[model samples]
Target: MALARGFADPVHDAQAVFRTVMDALARPGLVRRLACGLAPPAPLTPELAALALTLADADTPIWLDPSLAGCAAVSAFLRFHAGAPIVANPAEAAFALIADPGACPPFAAFAQGTPAYPDTSATLILALARLSEGRGLGFAGPGIRGRAQLDAAPLPPDWPERLQANHAAFPRGVDLVLTAPGRVAGLPRSAQALVPEEA
Candidate 1:
């Protein structure tokens, strides 16, 4: 019903959020908290809202998950604040926002940029129940020295396999930004997502 608020200081806040996102992406599987406070509609966390604000622009087409799409408040907030177009087709989107990661389509369904233009691929922003250290899946890649683990509960069962497959695509796969109440984590296409071994 009511329109949501954007950052208190647009320029500075956007820059701060953007920096946090860059840090998260640089260090895969590491969680970073956003200082900005936002109240987007249900299913969209503040972390996710901040992320969209920082990344999405008028030229970026965003694909919203069914649950998020159905919420008028969320759509209005995003449209008014981010000025990002909402696209019906996932493949055409530059950013895909998923409120329920377990209910999301397979990772392969989204756009995977061509080898010559890997930056054209879509970035997935997922809202998770919570994020913590050393519990769910393992990660190792670029910024990681050895290995890093993420506790992202309620993720899709096939996420590890999918992430590995995505990583295997090398220069042509989508990247992921996992968000919680106030924290976010990166799962770049270059990172390897490993299943925990039996204890």
Candidate 2:
């Protein structure tokens, strides 16, 4: 498809998406909207579409859980422009894009840091919904003096526990990007994640 026929050229759109991600990461926990242009296959939202364009590149190897694989056409798209390799498992992935964070596997199932190279852990980009500030919960850690509230939806039942376990490893847990329609918030492995107390 050509940009001439109501189809946006991906390379052109990727630039804007890149800016969104770069700035979002630079600021941490801030919300920024990204553009989504892919005529993405099923189970894909604009959030996930924009993310695939922005973060994937030649140097990265991405692992897509079953939820995301039908678009190998998109995979071919990545290989052509970004040269990013697609891998079979999370352990082999530099970046893992999760379509449904709620049902996504535990952090332990994916790669954590090795003693020699703690930074080897994965970077997870999660496509989420109901993006709002973590208004009710008190969140603290790097980049905040006391407690900072940012939008953080609840993950799986054990996700909070898993994140705590990941944090205990410090420089080892995966870095995260939580995204919605057009906005995103990052939870660097350095940040402490606390689930809200239910009312």
Assess every candidate by TM-score: 0.95, 0.80
Tens-place lDDT per residue, model 1, 37-153, is 777777777877888999999999999999989888888899999999999899999999999888988877789999999999999999898788776688998999799999996
* Model 2 lowest lDDT segment of ten: 1-10
* Residue-by-residue lDDT tens digits, candidate 2, 119-182: 6788888887766664634456876556656655546777667766777788777777888876
The most accurate candidate by TM-score is 1
State candidate 2's TM-score: 0.80
In order, the Cα lDDT scores of the candidates are 0.88, 0.69
Model 1 worst lDDT run, 10 consecutive residues: 34-43
